[model samples]
Target: MSTGHVEYASLNGTHIFKLIGEVRAHSCISLDKLLNKIEQQQNVVGAIVDLTQTTFIDSTVLGVLAKLGLKLKQVHHIQAVMLSTNPDITTLANSMGLGQVFVILNYCGDPSVCTLELTEEQHVTHSAMLNTVLDAHKTLMRLNENNQNMFEPLVKQLQKEQDCLNHDVQKQNA
Candidate 1:
């Protein structure tokens, strides 16, 4: 597998750190250095870890990312977003429960990407909405399991009622 190369650029006031090639043990040092620079930079409001070009990532590299995430959360309060197209890496992150800790996003297909300018308030609102949706989904799944029989019947009744209401409305219109 090819070794990793760390690239840095600034986009829309955010620091973009792109990890190209395979992220093995050696890449951690360079990644750490880039992260440190971003942390020290006052103008950087957010950081994106672009892993679109990464072919492989070892556990050691994951450990480094975990540590960096923790440090950023504690010190700078900077939200680190991971943009990866690699299925293996995405699965690994999901299985490890890293998604809850970081803003992990998948960018598939077209590689031409641009930074989105989001206000601080908008970012917070979006994060809150995401959390609310996840919580609601979990609650719905739990309710479905708890009242499977009741839910199925209730859903059927609602569908029947909706059909009747639609028929009545059509009749009235006609």
Candidate 2:
């Protein structure tokens, strides 16, 4: 039910776009359009997609990114960068073999803390990689916390039922 919005900005010589809100089937159309526009930019050397604000991203979104990466590579010779703290999203991206296709950056609050290692013509340091990982970890933790809160009641109810079942078995034995 969440809507996805993308905000574009030029930062540190990179065309940075932050994907805000939920990335679902409906949002993919708009996202695809935006990506097409970004791809057409002559000044864009590379692209960084910030998914920290994105609460949900489905497989369709991943496919779109994969296609975009391919197009960018073939046409502009530009690489893509993914910046997100969502483990599910990250894991999905990794599973789809998109990790090797794009440069995944780790971002803590300050984007500067994150360093990107570019294979094309730019080389970055490992510390920057660490920072990016740390940032992603922070986002993962937040998602975990939110998930825990959402499931706490169901967990407690299941625990209560389990306790009751155990008590009934003991009574029958007695």
Candidate 3:
């Protein structure tokens, strides 16, 4: 698979996130942070995710993107649009119940705007990575019963690890 990088552009109040190449859990932290920032932006009226260039997207990236769609729908009352020409990726999105939160489209008209690239954070803590992974799976679970069944064991394991990590932190602090 091709190496993945994230590129994005904000046009007026509509924000477009373009995923190129292979997108995986490593890029999810930056993507999550960007999504949070956009959610807090008062001017955001729309959201779009372009996956035309995406060769692969793992479950973590899918969860993060799904969270973005859910947040846009809940906060801005706008259904996020997802542009995908690749059949495999499109099938994955549909199977994940992403269609409920995002309007899947085959076309994305060119937008005349400069794009910025998002890079992964240099140093990510184990706790933070664990939290991101756990949260991403939880978000996925919330999408449908199929997802819930698919991710329950992983979520349970992550939750246990999180509890232990919290206990360790408390002990060190004490």
Superposed Cα deviation of residue 71, candidate 3 (Å): 0.7
lDDT of 2: 0.57
lDDT of each: 0.57, 0.57, 0.89
Best by lDDT: 3
Weakest lDDT window of 10 consecutive positions for candidate 1: 115-124
Pick the winner on lDDT between candidates 2 and 3. Answer: 3
Ranking by TM-score: 3, 1, 2
Worst 10 residues of 2 by lDDT: 113-122
CA shift of 136, model 2, Å:
25
Q: Write the per-residue lDDT of candidate 1 for residues 40-112, one digit (tens) a residue.
A: 6666567677777778776545645655565566677876888888888888765544564468888752455
Report residue 9 deviation for candidate 1 (angstroms). 1.3
Deviating ranges (above 4 Å) for candidate 1: 109-174
Q: Each prediction's TM-score against the native?
A: 0.55, 0.55, 0.94
Model 2: which residue pairs collide?
A: 106-132
